[model samples]
Target: MRAPGKLVPVVLLVLALVGCTNMPPPPLVTTPPSKPPPTKPAKTSEVVIGVDGITGGYNPHTVADQSAVTTALGALLLPSVFRPAADGTPQMDRTLMRSATVTKYQPYTVTYELRGDASWSDGPPIAAEDFLYLWEQMRRAPGVIDSAGYRLIDNITARDAGKVVEVTFDKPYPGWRSLFNGLLPAHLLKDAPGGWDAALEDGFPATGGPFAVSRLDQERGEIQLERNERYWEQPAALEKVVFRRADQVGVVDALRRGNDQLALLRTDSVGLSLLGTLGNTVAVHTVPRSATATVLLRPVGEDMSDARVRRAISALLDRDALVATGTRGGPGSTLRAEAQVLSPTAPGYRPTRPGGVSSGQPELAQAEAALQQAGYTRGAGIWMRDGRPLSLVIAAPAERESYVSMARELQRQLVNAGIQAKVETPSADQLFTESLASVPTGQRTTGAVHLAVVPRPVGGDPATVLASNFGCLQGESAVAGAQPTNPVGFCDASVQPTIEAALSGAVPVAETLTTIEPVLWREALTVPLFQEADSLAVRPELTGVDVGRAPSGPFDTAVAWRRAPN
Candidate 1:
């Protein structure tokens, strides 16, 4: 495995929280209410979700660690603007948005209205200017951080009071609506010290969510999230949503040992299997996270340096077989075989074939032909570069037993197909460093880091991976902030203009994807992998925890869910 962000992350906050819109405040708590107005009572479920490790840090705009504090903390802050609805979808939550109207296009602008009851946990109105301040702060942020990712937008404009906010992009970027999840406490930070990443550790300001910062325990385990009765929307479900910090591995353990009820995070299956073994009393919801997994493919030995050869190797991959092994737990595992950089469940995914690959049939003839066209000849047992054996290292998820097996099989398969292959196993940290070092090619860097493989992030948004990893991007890209998406080291003379156009907010998602296909096909960076099936194991006793295939993604409506009777 590789380390996280060895190539400098693209503005760290890739996982910022998106706030809810148009929610009617809780029914006024008057004396026994007015003459029996029949109403459904608010839900009350207190199930703790566990994080696997001690959070490295918790600054949304800048913190280095990816703790729950950071992920859940954004609820306290707010995304610059809430998009009301996700990309290419109808607004499902009408109660949350004051109004969903795209006032203008040509200049690429959208505005949202705040409900009159919209107020922070501290009872302050959530002004539209708060978003404006956030935009300005992001534009002017210094040092290296993720907020810069949005700052790269030269044409964004958020004007007006706490009710009206607008943004303008230089050109049409179809995914603009998806980026509406930036958060800011404009009134509090209007004249604060440091940016979001540098907020005072001892004391953070008021937030607009159901929970306020009641106890800031920087040295302890988590930020205890007491439900804010003053929040504008329906009050949060749990009285206390303890944003507990633990290791990813520990998450499963915490849940099974009865230490916690539910958990979310990339975790090992070891601890989870124990729950099943112990059987039913405790419910374990094993949902496949819509997160990306990168497999390492080293370019050492093989002439995979030739884009065609790499593309050819990408073709013969048996994604179904791969998934069978890796996600063998099936419904028991949350891993899915994705079709592109985005998950199969992601929106805008129009699969051309069963899983999007061209004739997944292992074509020995085709592989030979492609290599021949690239100026290479088949030698004794394997393909060669210059009288030397052609081989490269492939890194994968070693935490799973299947990873080791896959690494061995990958080496064997590549060899059988005429390219010599080897496996160079590395820890997660090493994996990141090695993958980054190998992609530029003949940086000879990792010496043998080759095929970094796995299902991509399935957030239904390409930016999930695009905003964070652009490995194929060479030299400077017009898309600033962080660019780790290009793993095949795809370099285009016109990549800058292309990315800019796609992100300009004017193009529709379908149109933008149409534009990116040919370019990606030419680069051979991310060849279409297979569709993934997430494994999930939920004890029947725990009700309301919904996990379904979504037009936008997996596990979408778990928002207002709850655990059944104990």
Candidate 2:
């Protein structure tokens, strides 16, 4: 996985609080009117959701402080230029944007026209300055989140006063739509004492969506949002929303006791058998996460660096068995076995078999034959070549229970093929932070891990991820300078051209991916196991519940949720 961006300490504290089972007490819930003497009230409904606590203020641009809770809340209170479709393609939100078009391909340029009626709760119109301010911050700010797309933009200028904005990019970036999904209000943040950090620490200054923050009680682990009457679009169906911090176990308890309406549970934390007990009382929704668990082979060593050896190892392990055991035979158990770096769900994914090598369904006999062809002779139940045992050390993080289980299962499977495999569960910091960096002079030996079980972050475009992991390395950088994601030192110059073409966005995504898929399988750089999916337990009465393709949770479409007719 890629290293996390700089975040505030408070946000980390909140995340830690949410991860542990012993949660803080609920916040003070505002009481309703005792007497019914007021005029007929607007139809009102409230939903209490149990989630991992909201840390890092509500600003989505603050990358370090951003979490699932932060992104979900930002989706409710801010205006997104484009929303992602089910296949991870960006679709323009007609409510906020009148139209968005790419006017030119070279020196890429795009023009956005904002809806005439769109305005902040404080009555400030959404204008070109807002876009300009965000662009400037993303370019100059050190702690801002995901500046890759923004850094490509040369400039953004206002046209026709504040109604339209024209953007020019330094290069042809295909994933431009992924940017500005959570636009911050410039007028409110411009004069903040500590800049964007201090301005957004308390909560949002104003809201453009259907809901606005009514109260934020961090000490009690709660956030309350009420309808935004100033919203320009159709009024929100639900009157109020309450987000309370709870662990996976607490979430199940809250839903069963009728204290909470919905909860998102990690499959690793809550087994499938436990969810089955809920039966028809609650609705379960499986959300696909933009990440995949893979086995990365170190490409530098003489023992395993050879492509034949990697292919043999790939053939020895059963990916379907790993998925089944890791997911505990749940909704995501039957995951599509992947042969290349790109995920099955990613835009440019294509399954290719080079030399008739099967991508899934392990063939132990073929694996043994390949090792024998490589001049390895079996002795004392282990393959040996040039007086060296065919032994491998696989490293995995201790936190993810699923990955640990997969590693153990792989270890057991490899033993049958005369391979001695050792699985090491290291601390997250050691495996992710220290081991990935270049070792210092006179330091202890770098953790020369032969294989690592890790997840790669997948987002709107696979180009960036593909380039970072598989592209050729520029120069000699030892394990000290090595990146954790590419620890195997596998860089193929042959695949660079196709990767560049995909990054340029000039070619059809499907065609580009289809061409690259075979090269990856032929080389056998990494073996992809399965894509990660999240599970949610929602009450049957809540309707219009939709899980977003983006990292945000079900709240992505919170405005559409309504109570079922009794």
Candidate 3:
């Protein structure tokens, strides 16, 4: 239920580069300062970048590329064919391509004219052949992200001595600019292993992105990047940027002390505290993030599995209460409730009911009757189902303070209803794998996963969201349950046609939602959670810090963002 999606690899690329050294270091964020908040901000000096360790390989094919990082990196080089226009439409930047045109009929082809002046960071002129190479590689590459986009292109033809690139799609495939989501080093990858299924020795040799990785400290989990002076856009104002791995609290403290310029705040106390104290700071820039967090009411657990019991539990859960008391709606008032995976910023956004936190569906009496139907009796202290105590384990990433805290609150509320609830939290890594992993498929992980506090990127449209992340979903609904354990689970039987229609750039928003709404209402795999606000504490001198990409992603012209007195 999110956009500008970053597919976290659960089964894809698992191993960190063991022997790949000449390989480009884990992609690092090039900053006004690449290093962590130094003892103090430099008057005019190199920018240091701070980031978490990207252990599972930074390859784009792998779901774990954490694409926002790559998008930021790509900002310096190739521009997306469709950039977010001021009018809320994704428009083609056309910096590399002189012009792109698509005819409505036959093969559903799209042809692009390359700007003769455009060149790779290495100085090789960009030709239509470069687009061919990218498409071919996308088709053949095993681990590439967004297979759907690649699947659409039936054939690639290069003409005019490889200066004209024409692509033929299988059907009336639309979504004209989705191809721009990809960033390529066309000159080098042109001859490498077609689809980059595995780590190529030097697949990322050419320089084009805003920053080219310069140093990597695997042992210490540190990375350094240098700006691409050859970048097509204005070269980065700063000389260097560095990233160091640090936890949430440490990152927050660094930001406060001016040691860390900015942080990609994950779900943790740091974000919470920042929300708590936002008013006291310069300004905290928050936005409607394109991700969802949900709770799957399981009826088959020890005390669950009984539909009646599950329904009772579902009815009793005052969703409004949770929206009011739990998550971001706490004291700081940072959380925003939403419907569907589309964030407010995503195109065609409409607020709807989340999960089964049913609106206008009160259930004190309904819960009592359902419990009785499940043969559950409300005793003095606990709930009784067949003379046994009704209890459930609210699984969550135990290591995440934010989750654990929310779990405790949930447990308390559940206790009042005579159900004993406990939190089972795991480490951050396990948390992701567990969320992506499913319930038992006949004793195997069936992807019956209930919920997670995952953050989704929010810069693009819903079509972009489906192509990037959020195809996998939870429960036995038409779309999600139709397929067992969707790797990119975003199943909405009705949504498929709209997606198909939207891809062709035809379906209107009202029509697309008309089809998508029923399936969503039927299976609440995704619940509306609190919205994220734009919260950034900046010095008055720091001008041009575009708040375009927040939560975590590239900002418009982040590198050009000056530290003032320019």
Candidate of highest lDDT: 2
Task: State the weakest 10-residue window (summed lDDT) of model 2.
Answer: 437-446
Tens digits of lDDT, candidate 3, 416-526: 888877666665445443454434221222334333433333344455345344332222334434432332233445455555565455775456656665555444344
Tens-digit lDDT track for model 1 on 231-269?
A: 666655556655565664455456556556555543335
For each candidate in turn, the TM-score is 0.61, 0.69, 0.66
RMSD vs true structure, all candidates: 21.3, 19.0, 20.5
Per-residue C-alpha lDDT of model 2 across residues 488-562, encoded as one tens digit per residue: 455454555565566557666567667877777766767777776667778877788887775565767888988
| Candidate 1 accuracy as lDDT | 0.49
Question: Candidate 3: lDDT of 277?
Answer: 58
The true-versus-predicted C-alpha distance at residue 305 of model 2, in Å, is 3.7
**Model 2: lDDT of residue 107:** 67
